[model samples]
Target: MITSIAQAVALFAATNIDDIVVLSLFFARGAKRPHITRTILLGQYLGFFGILTVAAITSYGAVTLLPAGAIPYFGLIPLALGIKAGWDTIRGIDEDEDGAGRSLALPTVAAVTFANGGDNIGVYVPVFVSNSPQVVAVYCGVFLVLVSAMVFLARFIATRPGIGEWLERSERYVFPLVLIVLGIVILAEGHAFGL
Candidate 1:
């Protein structure tokens, strides 16, 4: 069970490449206000890690009593989000989001993290059910790694001539497919966990 959870965490984290990439772009945009950027990071950390902790505890408590059948539905969530992301990319809406004109604050970054991490819950439910601290650690580690990757990748791509436009243009075509794949993986995990 623990091993399974670990695998799931690893996969979940790896699947978040798009988000890491998206977030990197946000940071690469010169971070209008350094202090505001820091606040956003703080909020993002607290919101994402904090919620993950809660999910772990909640799963630990109720998993035994919960119907195993309800598991796959949780996986469906990332699928939906991924699909939406892909759709947004396809529809040109993903590129429409720009934080440039806005003032940054703890609430803003935290809010963005919360919105982005919605799919985390879906990917995490099975991990939570397994009651593995290692799984939690894996999640945290994965999150941290992704965050770091986003920061560097975005910064790098931004520095390169024309890469920023390239990324923005590609996500519309690619983002929704990520959601679909995540959804399928989660649903499969749900079935595996049940057995």
Candidate 2:
């Protein structure tokens, strides 16, 4: 159980570190509106639930249909996404520019969260596939707690005047780099390259 908890924490942190910047931006906007913070939180949770649902279902399907030895091939998804993100970065394509000046509604926030989290499904599926059902539940529990911590930290950073701006500006660079590293780590850890 202790090992499961630790694994869950590591997995959640690796997958969701980029979300801090995004949540901070939302919180920054929410600071002005005041009432939208609750909406943002709700939207984040709803979107994350969707991501987890997809991962869980996909992992279960993989476990049922694929041999256990072949499960690590799922790591290819993140590796490919990482390479795409790096390529786009080199081409100076900024996909995060969407939703500028848009109203912060629940649906909008939820949609953005889900879209940003598309890569998370790739990472989660492989890890979840290797874990037992009990361990997966532990992972989910740990993830929920970390999500709350992430929101609180984002709110803190957003409330700080200059920090949010700095993070926003650097997120484009950091995001791709992190994705690339994460993909490599996932692949290496799963020995996907060996297979």
Against the unseen true structure, what C-alpha lDDT does each candidate score? Answer: 0.54, 0.68
lDDT of 2 at 52: 86
* Candidate 2: clashing pairs of residues: none
Per-residue CA lDDT of candidate 1, range 76-119, in tens? 55466566555654564533236352233465345445545535
RMSD of 2: 7.2
lDDT of 2 by residue, 1-195 (tens): 999999889888888887786677666544445466688788888888877887798898843433444445544544565576567758876434452422356765565556555567778888888989988999999988888888888788876768767655665565456545645655565576683
Q: Model 2 off-target regions past 4 Å?
A: 62-102, 164-195
Measured by TM-score, the strongest candidate is 2
Error of 2 at 158 (Å): 0.5
Which numbered prediction scores highest in lDDT against the true structure? 2
* Candidate 2: C-alpha lDDT: 0.68
Candidate 1 lDDT at 24 equals 47
Model 1 TM-score, all chains together? 0.51
